[model samples]
Target chain A: MTGLPMVVSAANLPARVRIHEVGARDGLQNEKTTVPTEVKAEFVRRLADAGLTTIEATSFVHPKWVPQLADAEQLFPLIADLRGVHLPVLVPNERGLDRALSLSATRVAVFASATESFAKANLNRTVDEALAMFEPVLARAKAEGVHVRGYLSMCFGDPWEGEVPVPQVVRVCKALLDMGCDELSLGDTIGVATPGHVTALLTALEEAGIPAAAVGVHFHDTYGQALANTYAALEHGVTTIDASAGGLGGCPYAKSATGNLATEDLVWMLQGLGIDTGVDLGRLVATSAWMAGQLGRPSPSRTVRALSHKEQ
Target chain B: MTGLPMVVSAANLPARVRIHEVGARDGLQNEKTTVPTEVKAEFVRRLADAGLTTIEATSFVHPKWVPQLADAEQLFPLIADLRGVHLPVLVPNERGLDRALSLSATRVAVFASATESFAKANLNRTVDEALAMFEPVLARAKAEGVHVRGYLSMCFGDPWEGEVPVPQVVRVCKALLDMGCDELSLGDTIGVATPGHVTALLTALEEAGIPAAAVGVHFHDTYGQALANTYAALEHGVTTIDASAGGLGGCPYAKSATGNLATEDLVWMLQGLGIDTGVDLGRLVATSAWMAGQLGRPSPSRTVRALSHKEQ
Candidate 1:
């Protein structure tokens, strides 16, 4: 009863770790069939009611690139006035940013990649070109008093390029921070990282003079190391994380990609460690069950499946 | 690169962590339908072929208590005499020990509980009474030159009593060691332990004059913290671990007892961090898939499932 060893920092534990629910945008984007706009909007409301302070409501990408998110215009305005929830939408380019801005989005996210091959495969541009492309959107958002989150995909490893270099990940992080983005999320696009790799990357970022508090980790569970990696990130002073409910979403291009880390599993681990995440476990389970019904299958989340079985 | 930061004890790194496979006995004990004796024997052969050095082949409990293992007499002799492999059986009382000795079992296990209520409910005896029951059996087994391992169930928490105290767990450990048991396994029986609890218990054991190397941890994945708990145990110098392949086994009496820590998942974590376990991942996956088919469902091992999907 020595009141938990004082080896780690306590000041960094945020009042609440803001969960940016990506189930609607990043989650639905990889679905084979297009989800109806109304169904997407209702899911957004259900997530908000489950104590989520922020949710990525939709992605305003071109229909050619992502037909699943084609109804972003219809879904964005439906829950725009929801109380106490910040709705952020993904803006792939200038056109996408304009659509989000037209709906009066308070927060928007822009994407880039750490490697040239992944950038070309995912965004139709080289690494430098993709980073340069987000400059205008970031500038426009900053001028209009809107917050922007910069996403650096394939931070640790890439599908085509194999092991991504540490300097490449740091260079993208610095560029995004310099472009007036408020937060930068380092994504493990293929989820090959172990806890050791996560600690090394975060330690490298700190040594490179990047603010640890402004960084978030997004992981896929392809290797079953996503939650363990998240724990390592917490040890390194990361406060915000990106996870999808029911472990939804898979890459359309990569053949072996799996869903992101499930929100229920992350919350379970965090709450058990007595870290505050402001999530209701019961509601989280119910919402995941409802979403799984919409997807016509059970969730890949171990926590959701285990708790649901208990209720039955 | 400061070289991985040496998170856990890697001095034991590259030293093969003996994964005492318990799938044959602990797994099938709670299964609903009785698998044929030949199926059980075949499972042991495939597991041995997968480079498992120690496998708990079966138990000698009466058919009325565990009907699933009633065919142990037939399955045991058939799977014996494999070179470099040790087949152990669980012996509850003198009758059970006599049964195992008749089958020429070289290794035997006795069960005790850390808490009085769990001991009474699970073994129909008090804590001291349960230990007393094993004294004569140990004497008889020693007379025959057989090794014995003692299982301390509910070392972390229990169904009847919540939050098992560390002192109680340590007392049980000392008793088992004093009784001439060669090894001791600490179980979370209900999967209610976090990493903090694991660190505290193992630290207490070291302070109480017990050699850390004599301990093994058996965890259930009910709360999704079993692997983390195992990591904490390894950090304290315990090497041998009890795991069921494909995350098999659950307690029939405990309400929420789910799967054990999956062997494939454990091997993946150990090998990724450069710990040797002498296991072939491909062959272990094949064995798990084979047993899963017999059980009429998929293996619960996430690593096997994820890797099989990649291979396909």
Candidate 2:
């Protein structure tokens, strides 16, 4: 069904999208209770079985900070042998990278904040200080042949700082790419982004000599703009979309904010548009339902709720 | 702010959009418990005070069928003197139209189904039979100098008949226009529509010689596609949108479907896009929060949830 004309008017959108599944790492990391290592491994396996090419397995952050993902070492090795999938772990610094190297991990990611307030609050460093901290991490990852993804949080709006300027985000994005990160994921940590903000940011990135292919968008649905923001990104030819299964990982900073856009919801729109994501949506929905059961609560995803109810 | 360039790339979108608030009539009618007439009147007053120019006040359906809206007669006169607002009521047939006329309602709406299954299930008539029934109601409404808005439900998909053809929707839309409805509201009753389906339906409507100005789009967030579908409609120059404050009115037929798109969510996007909606978003969010309190549940709207949290 790929490349079929669903709507000739939306012809500007790419024919295919690369979904970067962040459920296990970004999604579970925010859970109040620690997900068992076995369950985490199974979730990653289920996502891969659903045809996801990239599954962020876990974070190597110290257990003191993100205790939910303390079992990264145990979880990563269990899914290491999964064929034809990329299992990337989040590494906060050289120490985290050292742990990843111990496991012989082939891919890892580092996060920085676009706004100074978010950097100070989230990373305990200023914006420039956070970039400086990631410098050596990306350099060592490149030397060790590990793929590096740079995450810039608060790319659109900041709670303390209000509206973030486009130029500031562009400068930080350039710094990450200059340090040898293969891709950049623009994070709307507060979910305050709109389609216009998305277009302006992407346009600025393109003007700064970064190709759209090197950019991915990670949006929370706090203000119900994630899918619309994703649509705007796709219009600019950005194919890498970061979504969590079952809409997991609500922002700890924004208490009432929703989780990442549900992968099933994004896939529904893509499938309807005749854009290929290589995902079996039914299996994905089943995977979310399973996870929702394990969490002892209903999933926050509207698509999950709708489809699961239909099944019953 | 209306004409200000939000994103030069999105300059094609309409500079202003007219929001048709449906929380009072379409929303409350589906609730299990009947709202007090005084509260219903207050809801309408709040919605209008928030700068919503068009508010659907009540439905004149039989009290036996929809006991929730049985106090339409009492609710109408309470807000009948509100200035600078259009209060439209739903009139199912001549009896309902007479009730609306007795209340001195200047604007009224009628509903038809795009699929035969929904027409039979919802109105106890076939698609053609439903249109024939509306013929006289619309003609009488025209002669009374009352504006008529036609609602075409199940335009995208149906529970009994899946994937309704575009031609079927176009034909029904033409019939509604031919019957003298000043405007037609295309409804995704099952919430199964995607952007492509929206584009195809609107394109077919235009091909059938119906201008976009004569159309409004009503969507449910059932599969989480309401906002995205609305975006597609706006891209095609659709100006009027139907939304329910606090995301009221779940689909009785599709038990798990969500209510109409929250007016707060739609306003958040339009405000961020620099489009004029004339709505005080803060006031609108408060209104939804107030209604949610009365409904004894948290609102399903992400915008309402997020903003209300910020206030606290």
TM-score of chain A of each: 0.93, 0.95
lDDT for position B141 in model 1: 86
* Alpha carbon deviation, residue B297, candidate 1 (Å): 2.5
Alpha-carbon DockQ of candidate 1: 0.25
B1-312 per-residue lDDT for model 1 (tens digits) = 111112222333335578888888988886665789999999899888998889999999998889999998999989986779999999999999989989899999998999999888888899999999999998888889999999999887766676677899999899988888988888878676666577678888889887678887898777556676676566567788898987767432233447788887777667655677888877887788778779876666666666666566
Q: Which residue pairs of candidate 1 clash?
A: none
Clashes of each: 0, 0
Question: What is the TM-score of each predicted model, taking all chains together?
Answer: 0.88, 0.96
Question: Candidate 2: which stretches are off by over 4 Å?
Answer: A1-9, A251-255, B1-9, B251-255
Which residue pairs show backbone clashes in model 2? none
TM-score of model 2, chain A?
0.95
lDDT of 1 by residue, A56-160 (tens): 988888888888998888888899989999998899988989999999999999988999988999888988898889999999999999999998898877767
In Å, residue A102's CA in model 2 sits off its true spot by: 1.0
| Candidate 1 RMSD to the real structure | 4.8
Give all candidate RMSDs, comma-separated: 4.8, 3.0
TM-score per model for chain B alone?
0.93, 0.95
lDDT of 2 by residue, B136-240 (tens): 898899999999999999988887777788998999999899889899999988777888789888989999999888999999888778888898898889999
